[model samples]
Structures are given as C-alpha cells and as structure tokens.
Target: MTTAYISRPASAPLVGIGWMVAAGLCFVGMTVLIKSVGAALPAAQTAVLRFALGLPFLLPMLPALARVRLTPSHWKLLSLRAVLHSAGVGLWFFAIARIPLGEVTAINYLNPIWVTVGAALLMGERLPPRRLAAVAAAFIGALVVLRPGLREIDPGHVAMMGTAMLIASGYLVVKRLSEDLPAEVIVAMMSLMVPLGLLPFALPVWQTPGATELILLFAAAGLGTAGHYTMTRAFAAAPLTVTQPVTFLQLVWAVAVGALLFGEPVDPFTLLGGAIIMGAVIFITWREARARRAAIAAAPDALLSRSASGPAARGSSRG
Candidate 1:
C-alpha cells in the first residue's frame, strides 16, 4: 500500500479547515447559478454543460491520472462511482429548479448520515455506541429539516434525497480507491466521466443559451470545479474530523445568497434543523478521528512488544 498520506503535517488541520470553507462558498455559488439559469434547459443538459465547461481544469492532472495503475477492483468501483455521481448531479440540477436553494443545499447533509450507515454495512467498519448515537441524532435532524408533516412534500425534496444517497455511494467507492490511487487521479476521473456520462441524456434538449445565461453557465462551471478542487485539498490537508463541520457553512451561505441575491425566504426551522445535523456530523467525525489515533498509537507498541518477547519465549521453551 502507498504511504503517501501517512505523514501528513500538523498545519494540515488549519489548511483543511480553510479549504473546506472555500469549497462551501464555491458550491453555494454553483447552486445560485443553477437557480438563475432556471428550468429552460433540461437538468441533464445543465449538468453536462457544467462539467463540460469544467473539463479544462482537469487538463494539468491527466498525466497524474495516467501514471497511476488502476486495479481491476479500482476500475469497477470507479465505474460505480461515476454512475452514482452522474445520477446525483442530474437530480441535484433538477432540484435546483424546483426547490428553494437553501432547502436543496441543506437536504444534501444526509450524505454523511448515509455514508456512516454504508461504511458500517458495506465496508464492515466497526460502529461503536457513540457513532450509532451520532447517526441517530443526525437522522432526527434530517427529519426536522424535512418537516414532511408540516408541509406538502415536493418532487424536489425526493430528488435531493436521492442525490444524497447516490453521492454517499460514490463517497464509499472513492474511499476504497484512495488506498491505491492519488487524489489527483480520482478527481481527474470524476471530471472526465461526469460530462461523458451526462451527454447522451443532455443532447435532446440542448438549447442555445443567451449571452447572460451563457456567462452564468461558465461561472457555474468555475464554482463547481473550484469547489471540488478545494474540497480535495481539504482532505489532503487535514483529517476529516477537522474539516467536516466546516461544510455546514455552505448551508449558511446558501441561505444568505438565496435571500440576498434571489429573494428567497429564510426559514427558522431550516436553520435549526441544519444546526442539528451539523452538530451530529461533527460528533461523528470527532469520534472517528479519536479511534484512528488510538489505533495508530497502539500499532507500533504492539509490534515492539511482540518482537521483544518472541526470542525470550523461544529460549524458555527450549529449557
């Protein structure tokens, strides 16, 4: 296994936090742009164009992708990631047209809850009592955010939930791939695959965008790509525990931007619910980091103790 990520620096935590904040801002911008574009373009087409315009950003990383050797296993998982990611992008674009931007953005927080459940069930990761509690808390928070009983549920809500689930699945695949592939390779593959996968569905509804919408589209592409790049940097810089909570800032930015730029209303319930989810995610992330640290600290002592006692035990047996 590669050790490229083993000796991460202490400053990584700070850098990761900053990068995650930047990523959140960029994504908030992307969501606003999608709303501005409205429903004139097909959701699939918007998704495809967003990625197509972002393709140039991946050019410098292609050689890094080329250098990495993909195992058959990695390829299979990457394919799965691409499919799930494509679906998520499509549904999220659809939601942008139908839902308030803040609500749409807040709903995607369910991705972490799904990832937690998935890692336990699919990857067989140990889920202790604390993590289980964290999951439950996060789920409750999701309920508050949805408030299904309070208002009529729309197709937009369903689409956003589905997008979250698909994104969670994609995350698991990427986690598996991270063991063997560089982050750059994983990112390059995603940038390349999203447009290619989205194209067939996008083609039928292709429209000639006006100058204003065209500018928004390009800006959207920039935001989306920059968001991913900064997010990758966040992971590279610090442990997930350090950067995970920072993502909640996206919700704040979404609400603010939606209100100021688009005149969307800010709901008190949404803020409360979002805060609950963010708290749960932060707790879960912190617990995971603690577990990892304990494991790492124990490993070397275990090896040393085993080595030190081995020859003595052998000698005593001979006597």
Candidate 2:
C-alpha cells in the first residue's frame, strides 16, 4: 500500500493532456531511432543491448530499487513478464526496422484490444457485451490496416502482430504484480530481468553494432524510459478519459516522420485504421472510468481504496 505517484496539479486535466502528448512524442521519437538503426544488427541483439545500455538510466532510481522486498509470487510473475517483454522487444525491433513507421504504430494499437480481452479473462475484470463489441471493432481496425488479401503480408506484419499480443501479455502480468508492489520496483525489476531473458536469444545471432548505431540505440532506450515516466505522470494527473485519446497524436507524428525522413509513402489505410482502433480504446477506457466513479459514489468508503489499484498505481508499460 505504498502509493508512489506525483500529486495531481491544480489544472490536472490540462497537465495530463500535456504529459500525454509529450509521452506520445517520446515514443514516436524512439520509433524513429529504432528505425534508423535498421537491420544492421539482429533484432534480438539490438533489444538486449538497448536494455543493457538503459541500465545507466536506472542509476538515479537505485535507492528506490534497493529498498524493495519481493515475495516469491512477485518473482514468478516478474520472470514471466520478462519473457513476454523480451520477446516483445525483439519483435518490435524487427517490425520497426522492416515496416513503415506509420503502419507499425497503427498496428501496435492492437495492444489495448488484446489487453482488454486478457484482463477480462485473466484478471477477472468483467467484460460486458459492449466491451466485447468494442474489442471486436478494434480487431476489425487491425484488419483494415493489414488488408491481408490486398497485399502480401510480410514477416514484419506478422512480427508486429505478435509484438502487440506479447506486450499485452506482459501488461497483464505487470497488473498482477502491481497488486502488492510499487510501480518503481516493477520497472526496475523488468529493466534487469528483460535483459537477462534476452541474453540467450542475443547470443545466438549477435553482431557488434557500430559506435554510431550504439549511440542511437542508447538514445532510443532513454527516450523509451522517459516516455514511460511521462505516461505515468499523465495517468496520475487526470483520469484516463482526459489522456487516452491524446495517444493518437503519436500516429500523426509517426506518419509524418516516416514520410519526411525515411521517404516512406503515407499510407491512408493506416491512418484510418489507427483512428478506428484508438476510438475503440478511448471508448473502453471512458466506460471503465465512468463505471469506477459510479461504484466509488455508491460506496465511497468501501471502493476508494480499490481505486488506487488502477493504472495510476501500475504506471505505463515501457514503449
């Protein structure tokens, strides 16, 4: 029950929107850097090195991390999360390097859809008929983006699909761990564990990145970490209704970056599908927040404590 989060500012909604936009920008920037790295190094090696290089960023959080005491259950969940996250990182690296950033970002929107289903089934969160419909619409959005029959589906498409599912799986485990642990402890553990989980995969196909690639990947990793922090700030500052839709701005930035810098074509279908998926996610989040508020209102004393168990407590997963 150690609630570790920033106090909400007076102008909480405005501040939350700003933080959400900043988080989206950081994630888009990270995507650009990862794309710039290309296929020079194996995806697994790049992911392993990215986390390894990110170790320095954890230096400032050392004292907080050191104070943590985990139960055996936390260790088991953490290990499972590490495996999911490690695989996700590798697949994401592979997809970003091969696919247009816009499409990649659009397709990645499926993470929330997957999470919705996973949470209902595993976390015992009730998914009503409407929520199930929303989830279905989100999958349709993925179909709109992929349009499988229209074009040959490449390995990149497959990898990105797997990446979203794996990331959702990791998020589910993190939610379980968050039941008892502070957000910082879960992040610190994953920072270490994901690297270890990735090491064996990296060793099999490792190639030394050039110094320039190393620097770029390091910067990307930093942005990824900062993105997570900003996302947490957004959730802490205001309810999901105010911040969730703002994440769509990332699609705009990703598309712009892809075309402007990489000379990639602007894909209209990606944009449309991204909007579809984002709309579904926003609707789902709003419904959850509204329901939680109603429950809190009915029995404030009984449910107020449970409110802390939400995302504001769990923090955002790494990009």
Best by TM-score: 1
Give one digit per residue, the lDDT tens place, for model 2 in 81-157. 99999999889999998889988999899998899899888878899999899998898899999998999898999
Model 1 scores a C-alpha lDDT of 0.86
Q: Which ten residues in a row have the lowest lDDT in candidate 2?
A: 2-11
Q: How well does candidate 2 match the true structure in TM-score terms?
A: 0.90
lDDT by candidate, in order shown: 0.86, 0.90
lDDT of 2 at 182: 83
Worst 10 residues of 1 by lDDT: 1-10
* Cα displacement (Å) at residue 134, model 1: 1.4
Task: Give the number of the best model, judged by lDDT.
Answer: 2
